[model samples]
Target: MKRIESIKNPKVKEWRKLHKRKDRDLTGTFFIEGFHLVEEGLKDKEMVNEIIITEEVSIPQHWKLDGINLTFVTTEIMKVISETETPQGIAAVCKQKLAVHPLNWSKTLMIDAIQDPGNLGTLIRTADAAGIDGVLLGDGTVDVYNGKTIRASQGSIFHIPIMKGAIGKWLPSFSERKVPVYGTALEGGEPFNKIKSSKDFALIVGNEGSGVQQDLLKNTAANLYIPIYGEAESLNVAIAAGILLYHLRE
Candidate 1:
């Protein structure tokens, strides 16, 4: 174990760098805060690069943190690396391990340009709860490792495969596999329930404002929309995703 007390320390500088997307990309690692997320990282030991704890906090007796790259830092130092207003006093730096190729998925959730980190995170957590096999984050989508996203996932990020890529290039693979790919649209989309739910499918959700890209929607096996019978003009993307994910899941 290492003890770091200074914010000026080089190791602390590197740890702070994990706070940014570019740094995370360049280093091939990201930091996760909160005990649950740290626990998730610790469970997959090979993925965790380091575990950081504030000196003021004590490790739970049940934790299996033995032999890990553990570090204790001052509360001030913990604040430098933490994103939360009330720092949880624990965080972990973990290697990015998204699968290079799409998984052979029974039910996958494809997303396009979802800008809100909370929406993306909630959708992902919902997908996990619904037993979706993987989540493919298409271009223009917010970074999955964004702190708000990681928090929103509530540790579900570790439960499923998530990757980022140009969705247009990947849509064909689903078709080639004879998997049904569905897109969400505000208009000109079939009522979501019209298509009988199935065992194998990919559902592509879109930006909060623009909905799915037109070209991508055209390529899907079908475009779907939940009817708005009440005065509500729209559904939050996260809510829509929860409804659609559960409806489409086997």
Candidate 2:
């Protein structure tokens, strides 16, 4: 095993760059940190390009290393490359894959420019729990490869497939397929329970501040609002998404 110590190592600098979307694009690689996440990447096999491990850690069995490179480093060196304040002993350089929707999409989630990484990730994790067919992101949303988004998703990002497109472009595609596209909003909308979501429908959750776009609003089959029981004016986007997803699941 090779040993690395200095934070100034050229390889370390290049690894740090993987945190940014621009860098991930330039290299076609993104970083995954922590034992469980790296394990999850191992499960996805093809998505992981390389694995980095502490010198003493054991590579688990049943992982098909085949042609993947494994780099070993000191604990201090591991810390230097990690994005979290509390570093995970392992990380990986994973290949970025384009998401493709399966032909049989029964229930789906559409994300529209959700700028906050935490919210987007939380919504994604929730979508997976609800057994969504796929996730679609509109333009202006945070890069799904960003470290925080990946971490917040708790590795669910790897488990569920995500696709991206302009809202105007994809909304029509859903419409053409006879899938009812619904947006969660406050005005000019029906109570979520009032509208029925079955196997062939997509739910759109928009930006933290702006909500859904007006143009998309015109094309929506239904705009949904969570009827407030208390004086609370609104719901956090992720929570609202979970509620909508749960309501639709049955």
Candidate 3:
């Protein structure tokens, strides 16, 4: 194990930069905080570049960290790299796990312009629970590795392949492949239950305030809407995603 007692250490400075998306992209690595997240990263050894912990934290007995480098820093120093109010005393620097959709994917979730990290995380976790093959984060979607996004995912971030790309470009590929693409809409969409569910299909969920873009929705095989029974005008984007995903799975 290595010790980093100074907050001004050059390596510590670099790790702190990961809080910004540009830095994470440039370095090809991101930080995962908390015991569960770090544990999840450790499951795939190649994904974890280094494990960091405050001097107060002991390595979990179940973790196999033989080849992994461990760094111990003062609690204050850990705070420098942490994004939460109370730091969990553990974190890991993980390489980005690059993944892509296979040619024969069954269920896919396409997220478009979802700005809220929490909402995006919830949708990813929901998609994982519903057995989604993969998730595509569209042009304007929040960063999947954002601290809030990762925490919101509850470790599901490591359980699935999430690729970032423009929905417009991918929609055409799905069309070429004959995969049914469905878009969610605010109005005038076929009631979701009325549509026949399928094991192989792509569902596009839109931004919170603005539903799917008019142009992209045009490319879908059909548009779908959850029938609002009472007076609730709409559902939270994450809730809507869960409802649609499980129904489509059935």
Model 3 clash pairs are none
Off by over 4 Å in 2: 100-104
Q: Which stretches of candidate 1 lie over 4 Å from their true place?
A: none
Each candidate structure's TM-score, on Cα atoms with residue i matched to residue i, is 0.96, 0.93, 0.96
Clashes of each: 0, 0, 0
Candidate 1: how many backbone clashes? 0
Candidate 2, 1-250: lDDT as tens digits: 3557778889889998897789999998899898888888887888988888887777778667878888888888888788788876888999887686534576888888999998988988999999997888889999988888888888888888888877677776787789888987788998888876577888889999999888888889999999889998788999999999988875
Model 3 lDDT per residue over 192-246, tens place? 8887888689999999989889999988988999988899988999998898988
List the RMSD of every prediction in angstroms.
1.2, 1.7, 1.3
Residue pairs with colliding backbones in model 2 are: none
